[model samples]
Target: MISKIELLNEIGIALSAEKNSQKVLELILDGAKKLTNADGGSLYTLNDKDELVFEIVSTDSLDIHMGGTTGQSIDFPPLPLHIEGHDNLSMVVTSAVLNDNTINIHDAYHADGFDFSGTRKFDENTGYRTKSLLTIPMKNHKADIIGVLQLINSTSIDTGVVVDFSSEDQKLAESLASQAAVALTNKKLIDEQKALFEAFIKLIATAIDEKSPYTGGHCKRLPELTMMIADACDKDDAGALKDFKMTEKDRYELMIAGWLHDCGKVTTPEYVIDKSTKLETIYDRINTVNARFEVLKRDAKISMLEKQMTARETADEQAFKDAERDYEALIEKLNDDKEFISVANVGGEYMAEDKQERVREIAKYKIDDCEEERCNFFNEDEIQNLTIAKGTLTNEERQVINNHIVVTIKMLDQLPFPKHLENVPEYAGGHHERMDGKGYPKGLTRDQMSWPARMMGIADIFEALTARDRPYKDGKKLSVCLDILGKMRLDNHIDPEIFDVFVREKVYMEYASEFLTPDQIDEVDHSKIPGFSGD
Candidate 1:
């Protein structure tokens, strides 16, 4: 048998080690009951309303268990610490809290200077005797009363008869109550700090999203998709992912990483992010190019009319006819070139080599500028934007966009995260990296990165491919997005094991159903998806 001193030490350690609030309360009540050999006990916490709320109640003789981990509510009304601006000293538990002292009653039925009517009523209804009571005020290190611990019916060890709680029992209970109060207070403080930290993180994400309408929900969606794939990998018990698992702490850390993956984008220019066309800056420059085309057509028509007048004055019918034909042909060719430039300005997945050459050819067509000086139809900046091989961003602008990941890494590295979340910088910063060592910011290979970082890579791609709110293009259908994701997998851009789990578990469909529009949700043929065998 464990000695009383040994038991007390063990209970104190257990109270300090417990993380769950309910379990801590349960431990405190159980430890007090064991120390006194009491038949029943209850724990009360002081709420913000100045009321003592019942946290746990246990009676061994009646087989009664309520509150705490038992999932049964106490159902009793809270006892107010004050009534009509005065301390309610009538109740024994409240009196212990009000006086900041322990009260030991030899027998409740004959107790003095305190009300025991409730105890008498309870005994009458249950056909049990009301006997000895010991109530102690629970105080923290600050010497402030936080709660009350009440023990009932301390029975003798040999005779099993009710006895008063001895002086030794009171001392032991007070020491245990002190430990419990500190442990509870520390846990509450830690929880509040964590909540505040997460709220601030989410606030940053929301601010980044609000910076651009094109990326209105990217920050929110990426975390959800990342978690979905992570959950799939966690549950997978086959092949490369069978060993993968996450505790609640690990899950929370990953969630923070997901929210912060694109934190660097806050530094990126909004014009580059929201560029809707190849010729876009503050506004589309194609409109300026179109105006120049109009000027060229007017010049050609004026020259043709002058030639016609000269031919008529010289009586040369052939010259006049030639001028008319030339004017008609020039107008048609100008319209064709203007239409072609409009299409090129819109941009697409691939701009053919022939069409790129046509832009250069059109740039050679000269016109008088606003200064009345002769210059090429298209300026150097305009030509650079118009002839982009793919997407709206020029190489320089693309680099500007990619620099956000570097900034994100730097920002997260400066923070002094705790041990559990120490990997957040790695996870958030590595999302843009590749398995083949071809990714930017840091060309880390698959072996150099964690599974969570690789999972984030897939989520980032999938969300970008399927997001409907982007200014550049409409959201791709489910099959199309999966097809692109499959190609990326084949190229070693993402983790093959995570991708396998993602497809096998149907995480894409699950996400699509929740976030994708009806038109974006199309039939997906699993066998046709690239880089995946129908296993």
Candidate 2:
């Protein structure tokens, strides 16, 4: 008979490791098989619908493999549980899953005439005789059945001395099953939490999309690409990510940070967020430049006609035709490239009035009626909120865009988190803050931030600079993007020491390897990237 002390010792050993439900099951099955002097075993876990699902102790040798899922809605058939005693093992262990239902069976297989003919694998592989069996139902603290564990052919396992299933065998199997249930339950809870998190992200992204047609789904791609970058970061800096040791609390914090990172976008004005041109609010006024070209054309035509009339007085027709053709060619040249549109505003930085007025005059003839209406149709409150000026936005509009960090802090503050999640608010909020005081919304320097916050800061910026999904910008090639970030490091906008780690780790290249498409990666010159080498 296996002693209680040995069983408890093994249980403590199995549960000490972090996460992954399957390892715990393998431990239970292996431990029970050894304790009961049995040849082989399997663990069956019950799902939400009360359907059984096999966890581990598959058809091969029963060593533990972790992180596998027997989750969702898979079906598991019941084994022909041997009933040898007065008590019902299934009913008792139903408590493992159900939590309140417990059956304390003592001699689980004794008198119910348990059948062996229905058995499969243990005989198929071993080619050995199988006669006796012990079965026990797994129960949680609440007495619900999480799983059923069965030990086949109890005997002198090493010496091949055949023996019948003992009362000891039944007790041991029941104990192991109970432990397996708890592992299964925890795994299920984690899955449910993950699903809820994904749903919440979709909801928030949709709300951001609703604010402007131009940024219809910008926020949604940020988190996806953030995760993809994180994965690359992990691979490139596996040693570094491991140094973080990322506790369960750390994982939860990173998750919240990713979703809430762009909360600042909420405060940014839709027009500024969707601005398609340098001096754009209502009209681009590009047509003004075209109008100036048209006036030039008119002047050219008038001169040519006068010259033609004068020439007729002198009897010369070819010269007037040549002048007409030259004017058309001049207009065509002005039309191409259209003088790379520039506009002047009075609020933040004023554009030169002469240049501004000259462009405005050219646009006069091409101005559509709707263009005027959209220009003047500004909402008093929204305009006040946006702080847009004639030439550029007031300093206030820039602050509003930057206040997305503030919005993130405010929104995350409202979530009621479980214990130790207090840091979630700070970590998520601090993502945009520079290592130096250059970042907005509380420019607390390096010592004030946690390692997790620093990692997040790096992740957020790297994703943004390389990201292609923003309404106003195209994604940069890896070399150009990293060069900018590297310069920022030099400027104290980012951590200089961390930048070294970033280069040595080749974090950007590894990230781009996965994040950038085949054509996208191919477009960049590898050697030019600030921190990467061709070798």
Query: Evaluated with lDDT, which candidate comes out highest?
Result: 1
279-382 per-residue lDDT for model 2 (tens digits):
45566433543464565566567877787788778776777677677767766754542552322222222344565444444343332233343232222332
- Report the alpha-carbon TM-score of model 2 versus the true structure: 0.66
Query: Candidate 1, overall lDDT?
Result: 0.92
Error of 1 at 261 (Å): 1.6
What is the Å distance of residue 179 in model 1 from its true position? 0.5
Could you estimate the TM-score for every candidate? 0.90, 0.66
Over 4 Å off, model 1: 73-77, 109-130, 297-339
lDDT of 1 by residue, 274-298 (tens): 8989999999888898898899999
Q: Give the top-scoring candidate (TM-score).
A: 1
Off by over 4 Å in 2: 9-18, 47-51, 58-115, 118-125, 139-144, 156-160, 168-172, 179-183, 202-252, 266-269, 278-395, 419-422, 471-473, 517-535
